[model samples]
Target: MSDVAVCSVVSHKFVPAQGMPVPGQVPASARAPRNDALRCTACSMRAICMPQGLTSDELKRMESLICPSRTIKQGETIYRANDSFQNIYAVRAGSFKTVVMHRDGGEQVTGFHLAGDSLGFDGVSSGHHSCDAVALEDSKVCIIPFHLLEAMCREVKAVQQHLHRMMGGEIVRESSQMMLLGTMSAEQRVATFLLNLSDRLRMRGYSPTEFHLRMTREEIGSYLGIKLETVSRMLSRFQRDGLVDIRGKDIRILDHEGLVRV
Candidate 1:
């Protein structure tokens, strides 16, 4: 609701509220999870996207706080620029890319989000989204209605602190991107992208040395402020030098130290 999230001043007991749909919201093309219940403790992404200090009592309430997760197909827009900000979403499955289009029809890929990532923060300041979030694959997102979330934050100090930390992380990520685009060499940019993605996957309990790239070279180029040809060339060079093994979207980091030196 605000540029920076603040815990609500009014305190009330946390309650299990029903899902309140957005006006004219798009119907989910797929069904909700099996059994029609979500166990936050059992969720793979809880450690990444959820508050760490929630007691068992508090975590139970989160089942109702986050509405049934929605599954969107590849190429579907999660939220477009200018859409009203009603909820923030967490990726429960798959990945997404955020893009901004100029008046002249040119587009730039701003960021890539994988499972355990959050979306919709771009809308907080203006009450409307500033970019388009599109799934790179069939993806599912846990939607948290903003008003209810604000109320939860008011009564839960741990939840409030977690929200603030996430918001701060977003700012730091953007600033790092600025530095990447402004000063990094082409090789450094490409290397950093791979290393950064590797680190995230590792954090999410996936193999750090081997993973698939959900986004294409052109998409990576746009995000890195480089040409598509350069992206391809960099990958080719890395492979030739035995720094990495990349075939299509599948990549294996052959030499982490070698890549890092770039």
Candidate 2:
């Protein structure tokens, strides 16, 4: 594969994560019903996130408070390393990945954010971003002017709690990544990544065990701290062992327990 093919490119055909309605198309009956469109947007993460505590009026106010920017093309940088932080960005659509470069010229993927995921939290403290955020596909983001969101959070208890919880979650995720890289064998790392992806997809309201890979095997290997050929070999082995099914970019976990035992 070409080096360019290994890099993630955000495409217009990208689907939004769960909790977002189909973009730009609304049923005629939806217009007359008492059903609020934002509720449809709030289908997931209702109990644990900032959107949950906001009243309809507050949400409307939030919509107006934040400025909507044009969709970012795949591979476009949202912000580069050392860029000044001006706004707290919320992913309104599509996905993003953060990359940090090492002094040795190696690249480490810090995290991947899907729709409704919050970015810019780290920048709040650093003032300048430590990593580069690039769109995985054509994506929309809402720029919540930092000053406005800061003031609102001071007044809203739920928003404060939500931010705290999100930060805590970040710590946990990083810790999990460390464990995966430090402890797991190549086969185990691949298995764990498969499980992790399945969990994340399920959280996004997709099939947990069966889905397409958004990131390339090279990217996967990079993130997991392994060689690309090792990733490919292990995957081939998994397929041969009847633990997984791989076709094109699509993957299906045929034996969950067997995968765990890898």
Note the clash tally of each candidate.
0, 4
Once fitted onto the true fold, the runs of candidate 1 whose alpha carbons sit more than 4 angstroms away are 1-20, 23-37
Predicted candidate 1 versus true structure: per-residue lDDT over 1-262, tens digit per residue = 0000011111121122244455344223112332454566678998999998788777766555677677766777778888788888899989888789878777788888988999999998899999888877778888887766777899989889988998998998899899899999999999999999988888899999999888878888888999999999999999999999987889999999999999
TM-score, one value per model: 0.87, 0.79
Candidate 1 residue pairs in clash (backbone atoms < 3 Å): none
Q: What is the lDDT of residue 165 in candidate 1?
A: 90
RMSD of 2: 7.9
Against the true structure, candidate 1 reaches a TM-score of 0.87
The Cα error of candidate 2 at residue 79, in Å, is 0.6
Best by lDDT: 1
lDDT of each: 0.78, 0.68
